[model samples]
Target: METAFADYLDEFTRRDWETLDPEAVADPVRVAVVGLGWFAREWALPGIARSAYTEATVVTDVDPDAVETVAAERDVTGVTPEEFRSGAAADAYDAAYVATPNAAHLDYVRAAAAQGKAVLCEKPLEATLDRARRLVAACRDADVRLMVGYRMQTDPAVRRLRDLLRAGVAGDVVHVHATMSQTMLGELGGDTDQWRLDPELSGGCALMDLGVYPLNTTRFVLDEDPVRVSGRTRTRHEAFADVDEHASFRLAFPDGVDALCTVSQNAQHASRLEVTGTEARLISDPAFYEREDRGFAVVRDGTRVDVDFDQVHQIEEEFAYFGHQLLADEPFHPDGEHALADMRALDGIYRSAETGRSVTLDEDAA
Candidate 1:
């Protein structure tokens, strides 16, 4: 049995959120949400509203009704996608959160950069590798910082996982198993016309939408990029004709570290990740949903230590971090260039699945 140290009992509880005062931000970043989808309306806008460093000032979508409803409900300006792309209501925002479908991300991001606004483009970067490359180049050429919307990176528990791994708390990481799935098809009533089912619009299906959470989160926690990947995909439903329905992939990283990940679009809602190392193991259950109450634990030496981080909202933390970095003129991790690595890896995964072989990212990296 491990003895409980009592010498520092008084210094027990701490609050990280209290340290970063929202009022300390002299100028909060006014944000324009470019997509009026459910994520933008429910998650992005609400997160920005709750953030100390950011405010949602503008909302836009191709659907005027969605724009009107959200803008009116939130008391923000609403514009058509074309108007937003044309830089109308430019003063309303200092940054743009591009939440449009994967294929449409480039146009909006390019427009935002042209308007001298920083970008927080959602994950997968864009629909495909070639377009993702162009998107990153557009931001680079325009000289605006771009950060991909990987909210887990800003989550406290995930950050602590990274810290622990770096401190050798997990010893030498050996293997990781990650699985994430959701009833997205059932939610939308098996709508095949949706962008998620459209390969041209969504890049891939379950892998791109759900599996990327584990894939990217593992990369962030390990601080290592995958050198090679092998994947097998399945399309069991008619809705997944043009895209993957379920996918299982293997990612091989440097230093003998490897991760196996799986995702499904029409299955029971579940997300889990377990990392095993020589000294300790890290586990996260219900890990991928940013809005859910997830649990994390570290187990070793015949003991299990469950972490109880403050239940901070992932999207809100992401907004605050992005805004604070922009205000401080600092660079963003998982920035455009860094995000391209994920894009390349995803592309390689798809290629490997198609060719029924393994794919190495060295050629893409080179």
Candidate 2:
């Protein structure tokens, strides 16, 4: 297992982060990762391992077999869910990473925050807006930092796009079209025990599972909130009888910027983000995912300019930023308020989809 982890470490090169002083990275923030699922194992673990300012000291999960498997590969203490909720476990770490199922997020977060530990929660905040608000308040009352894991918000390509828009390379941004889809049914066929398929566990369906990407990414890039939303959804397969298989929605921002976004569980794998303005347009062919290499292009005045970035890891930057917030007293980006805003927008979207009418959102809902 150690040999395998060493090989995994070799697959990626070390990154130089501008946010922290390489020589000054000491007393790494100890983190307890609650949930040993696919995302936690595949992405979050590797990302946290590469950081100089953070250490994953403890891991928790309900399945003892899964916990044993992960514990063998990593040098971290593995505890069952019951032990993790106890007071002794809370005192063992400075922060907790909540990567449990969607429905379990709030409970894990509150447990960690109750221990006076900072929390890095996986996206969506909660299954519903009302619950999400309560979760945020709990963390605030505990006086702990709460950051949502919107990995792409720290992506180089996404940040470059934002910079171009700020530089007026796209003039006044007018429209955005974003799409993200994956064949979940084909990928995990007949896996009824999969928590994501259960509406109670996953909150909604495709929108809650996949739609949050385009929805949150657009808002991140634009740095603006929408005033209204209209949405429609459908469940195309019996396997997804309890949840949506596809969803489409449009958001109207205050400054006349309109965003059309779609998510699906029954489509060819695709992820793209395009923004149009009066002067030019910017496009990210394979946008919003953590990858070694991705391209961003700009089309202006009948000429195209392309920029290709070297190997970059979104998860690495995410944990590094969390470390920055913990160690350097830096304000956390995409904080709880950010997730709450997205939740509010999604709440309006689901309502609009159910009633077949546009839903208006209050700008000052916090």
Candidate 3:
């Protein structure tokens, strides 16, 4: 007895199952999550656990107690950083998620890659362009995947915006303006001695922490790299020591499209982005990276259209996407090359700040 539902299932199986072998199922990719801090436990590990293609096999942290607490809470086992250094913990996983502090990302990523493990590292790949380039080259030499946490790349709204721009819905992009700022409340506030407040450790001030959002977003949406950058920074608060608490930058793309970005640690909560083109404009409220109650409004010829999006857990989506790529042997986008580009841009920003002039990217430098 032939049935309509049977045919539907058969069609799906025929098209999608061509590359899948029923008898050759592979084991889930084993993942070791580094750092048991706020982000790792509450977000990354949980997200990895929720992913269908990867298993959270282990966790590691420098603080033994913190690691043990998270392992108990998440029902997963972990090793202390000392144990990991001894190579006892390194053999237990096939991949790692490096969620350590900004300063620690380089060393941790190197160690994981040396151990023949694919690495998913948190953003700002490293504190400097030199370090970022070295890490990318090292990963390439090791023949392992190195992915940076540009999680906004997986946001549906961001994806849609990229699609619109690529599809020429907005015509030629002429300008981009983005802002990501919030009061440095609670732990986000530097206590005169916090690592993030230290220029040496944090790489920069609010720009490195929050400003990366706009920088990365503009690049992603425009699908172009900045050829020149000019910027100014000011230390509004004494808490940041030598680091600037507020800063702004103007990035000029190859086609004369300019991107204006601002980031601060002392402003009231506000994150907004707008892309103005020859035909229309796309504006997003709140953070482009956040998955809270947010939407994008398009304006053209005095007509406005607002599109609401479902709340999505970006961490979950990011982890799931990484896991799926691993399982399917697909290449991961925004890999080390992407991180190197952002770091290069950041290098330009710092140069602009130091000299108070626009700095151009040296293509060969990256």
- Best-fitting candidate, measured by lDDT? 1
| C-alpha lDDT of all candidate models, in order | 0.84, 0.82, 0.77
Against the hidden reference, what TM-scores do the models get? 0.93, 0.92, 0.89
Predicted candidate 2 versus true structure: per-residue lDDT over 91-189, tens digit per residue: 668999999888898998988888899999998888888889889999999998999999887776777677667666677898999998888766556
Candidate 1 Cα errors over 4 Å, as ranges:
1-20, 188-190, 363-366
- Candidate 1, 99-119: lDDT as tens digits: 999999999999999999999
**Rank by TM-score (best first):** 1, 2, 3
Q: Candidate 3 vs. truth: CA RMSD?
A: 6.1
lDDT of 2 at 59: 89
Between candidates 1 and 3, the one scoring higher on TM-score is 1
Count of backbone clashes, every candidate in sequence: 0, 0, 0
**Model 3 clash tally?**
0
Tens-digit per-residue lDDT, 277-333, candidate 3: 998887877654343555677787788877654656778768767776777787788
Clashing pairs in 1: none
Please say which candidate is ahead in TM-score: 1 or 2: 1
Q: Quote the lDDT for 37 in model 1.
A: 80
- Model 3 per-residue lDDT at 264: 87
